[model samples]
Target chain A: MWSTIGEAGEFGLIARVTAQFPGTGDVILGPGDDAAIVTAPDNRVVATMDLLVEDRHFRRAWSSPEDVGRKAVAQNFADIAAMGARPTALLVGFAAPPDLPLSWADGLTEGLRAECARAGGAVVGGDTVAAETITVAITALGDLGGRPPVRRDGARPGDLIAVTGPLGLSGAGYALLEAGVLGPDDARRLVGDSAGGADPGWAACLREHRRPGPPYAEGPRAVRLGARAMLDVSDGLVQDLGHIARASGVAVDLDSAALVPDPALVEAAALLEQLGAARRAPVEHMLFGGEDHALAAAFPPGTDLPPQWRRIGTAAAPGPEGAVVTVDGAPARAGGWDHFG
Target chain B: MWSTIGEAGEFGLIARVTAQFPGTGDVILGPGDDAAIVTAPDNRVVATMDLLVEDRHFRRAWSSPEDVGRKAVAQNFADIAAMGARPTALLVGFAAPPDLPLSWADGLTEGLRAECARAGGAVVGGDTVAAETITVAITALGDLGGRPPVRRDGARPGDLIAVTGPLGLSGAGYALLEAGVLGPDDARRLVGDSAGGADPGWAACLREHRRPGPPYAEGPRAVRLGARAMLDVSDGLVQDLGHIARASGVAVDLDSAALVPDPALVEAAALLEQLGAARRAPVEHMLFGGEDHALAAAFPPGTDLPPQWRRIGTAAAPGPEGAVVTVDGAPARAGGWDHFG
Candidate 1:
């Protein structure tokens, strides 16, 4: 099923995909119009966007069409939830070679549909184009129901830090697939078991990597409970917490011993290393590798951790003026990924 | 001037360009957030999108970076207005080569700024990445103030067709440019004048091709004045009107003699052919050429033309089976750009 870039062209593909999704009343006008008309419950709309280019963001070899589609939607939905907003609608712009199979295209749409259904959002509209490689640009819109947006710049000294999901699973999964140690069937089986929670803790981590389960309800919950500040851990825990610390003019200290997901990852680490498959930096990888898509927040002391959240650290007044994030009392070196660098 | 794509990585470039724009109040969230938060009046947001690739949409040799940027914004904005909506915000995704110049990037941003200012919208967010060539995907959001979207399917039989601005000048200007008949100064001078006017209209046509005046306000005006069906004339009048005929289940009869912009296009057409240019097909050119960005609508007969509109044709009930568009009582040929055959 090889297809060239010129066959389908952009507009034809868009019309085809747009026809598949049934419209809700909120979408007064869908894909064919100049713009889609979506009614918000009140007057506030939360909009977030992400772009994924072939080879750079995902390789066709590692991810199936369905996985790529699901990952794109899941990551974006995480951003909205991190804002304490409910996902509402999505507008996608896809660029692919004209010769790509209609089945591949259809599979991508189905992937989006599955994820949107999980998050309670709808794919309202999108644009498609003929290009040399595949690219997906997604803009996710959400509603806050009129709540003040929880910002990263509001954490204060004496606030407790917490996270709502596991970490380092995606990076680990990528490592396994890249090393040829895991075939598609094996990868799927592992990921599925993790999702189905046969090994509750590691399953949580694997699921965290493949398709993140954003703490959707926890966003507003944090806002209602007076969270001092917040952000999603797309870029590993220490690096992301550093963002809050720097933004708030404070210092963050994480007690890694208390992180329950760490031990589960240790087992995978040992297994891989025993097979001579582990990279040199296992702990560093878990601490700095990103795409976890978990929520991290700072709250006043004594505030109860929501049912989904786990206390990870504490925010303290600026330590030596410039220090931001410290693990085990020392400023951790090597922040997260820098696309420009 | 040349900047490697790696040097101007995605986030860095987005940060740089975003810093150049002024923020509006309704923008609750700006570039750095997961997505922007915009105030959607009437609780509904209107969104339209357009994709322009390097060779297909614009040739680097034919148009400046500024011109390309302007065209991108103009086309997308026209779609917003065709929906009878007021423009609000834009989200852009840009993919370009690593070796492209920083100056070219900056110039393109300037063009986007200029068009956004003209349309009364702001560039709210965007994504940037490396690609074999430049590709821009823009999503424009608009507000309709609770008005029903004027759709192409709404035109009833017996409606009079009207146009809000001049047409066919863009094709004429393109033909002139291709022939190299005019010097740079004269060509620049003829950029924005209309064809039927005393001026050469080359400048107007050229401007129309590069950055069209969409008559954004007229969309709402037409809807308010009882327009049954409306669309912007990206393709030429004869062809675009045919779209309405097909979509609305009616036949359109256009009075060719009444096309006021025809005379203004003659001198340029003659000059090109005289300069050893091949004899171009006039109807073929006018019927299929696009990018004018003029607004077209259908209204009941005797209905007052909105102040911005001029009478062009009339619609008749569908004849036995297939709807048709006739120019001077003859069947009009199907003419317009099609991405896929």
Candidate 2:
């Protein structure tokens, strides 16, 4: 086949791409219309966007087109959950090389649909273009159910800092993969398995890295429980905690003694440490390596931390007027991942 | 400075990147928060997206980062406008090489902000990442004010076809630019000087290319006048007309002689043609060269075309039933731009 955009044509291309997606009822109008219509519950929508470029966000060596699609959907959905809203719909724009397999494109859409299905949402509309590499831009829309959005600035003095999901596994997994220590089975286990048992700690960590299982159900629950401030930890724990502290004009101190890796995770790290190649401090890794997609929040003093969440620290008024994050009574270093430095 | 992502940690990078952008009203919460809060007016938000990748959508030689940003914002906003909606905000995701200058990134944002201002919208949120090449994803939100959305499926047989803006200057300009025939002054005249044009037609056509001035005010008017089967002419006239025909299940025949090109455009194209150079067909070029952000719609017989729109054809039942897009009793060909073969 000749490589020319003239062959598929704009409308034909749109039709072909859109045909790959199944309809979700949230879409009042799907891809065919001039503009897709979506129902906005509460007459309001929370919107966010993320773009993942080929080889920048993920490598073909590490992820299939399906995994890329899943990651894109999961990350955006996590943003919505972080806002105490349930994701309802997504609009994705994809740019890919002309020579790229149509199957790969279809797989990406399938992965997006699958992830959205898991989150109770659907694809509404999108645009596609011929490009040098794949670029995915996803706009996630969520419904707040009339609840005032929980913000990062509401933490108060004496508030307990907690997280609903395990942390530090994604970074460790990536490190291991990059270091080439893991074989096919081990790599698959590290990247795909989410159960808490294969070294419950390591499994949890690795899964956290792959597709963060944001505690979507817990966001509204935390809000209803009068959570003073909250945010899903997309970045590392200590760093995100620092965000809460700065925004709330407070200080946070973590009790490292109370922090312990799950035995399985410990064993995995110990093995790596035994190999004399581990750059990760198990506790430090969990605290500072982000992408866990965990829910971290501030609750008023004495409020019980739910079964899914673990209390890690307490907030106090900014000491000497500046916020601080102290680990084990000392100044904690290393905040988390930044997109630009 | 460190050469790779390995230097400044991802978390630190994000902090430094986002630190420069101060919070605005729509951002009730800012970047450091788990998620930012944005108010949706009337509980409705119109959203659309587009992705542009280097070499595919642009070349470093042809466009500056700022130009890319403006064009990205402009095209996405035009889609919202086609829906008879007012743009409210935008979210942009960018991926580029870490070695790329911060000045270029900042310049791109400046361009985005500037273009959004033209449409009464603001950039609300975004994500940035390191990549092999620059890729931009822009998502635009709009408000429809409770009106029934103007759609592309409403045109009926016997309706008159009209366009709100000029056609084909972008393709013409691009042809010249790609041929290396444009002097600096000619280039500016083609892609710059968006406003204050004494030549409305040339200005309209060039504006259609660089930053399409979608008929913002005319959208609501068209909806109110019972305009049916509306769309933006992203592809050339004949091609887009075909879409109207297919979607409305009707045929459209144009009177080519009725098209009056602006004198300046005619002069320019004539000069190129006389030199046996330009491969672009002046008339055929307008018929198929796209990127003109003009509005097209079908109206009931005898209905007055709006002040800004020009009546171009009439809708009839599809087929020798009528030529789907006949120009002077002949079948039209080469309708418009195609994305993929």
Predicted chain A of candidate 2: TM-score: 0.87
* Residue A288 in candidate 2, Cα distance off native in Å: 1.4
TM-score of chain A of each: 0.88, 0.87
Residue B172's lDDT in candidate 2: 65
**Candidate achieving the largest DockQ:** 2
Stretches of candidate 2 off by over 4 Å are A1-17, A181-205, B1-32, B184-208, B279-281, B321-323
Q: Give Cα-based local distance difference scores for all models.
A: 0.73, 0.70
Deviation (Å) of B327 in candidate 1: 1.5
List the candidates' TM-scores in order. 0.89, 0.88
Q: What lDDT tens digits, residue by residue, belong to model 1 across residues B133-219?
A: 688888888778788888888888889888886577677667666765333454434443322244454455566666667788898
Candidate 2's residue-wise lDDT over A97-206, tens digit each?
77676667666877787788788887878788877777888888887888878887899998988878666676666665565534335644544443233344454444
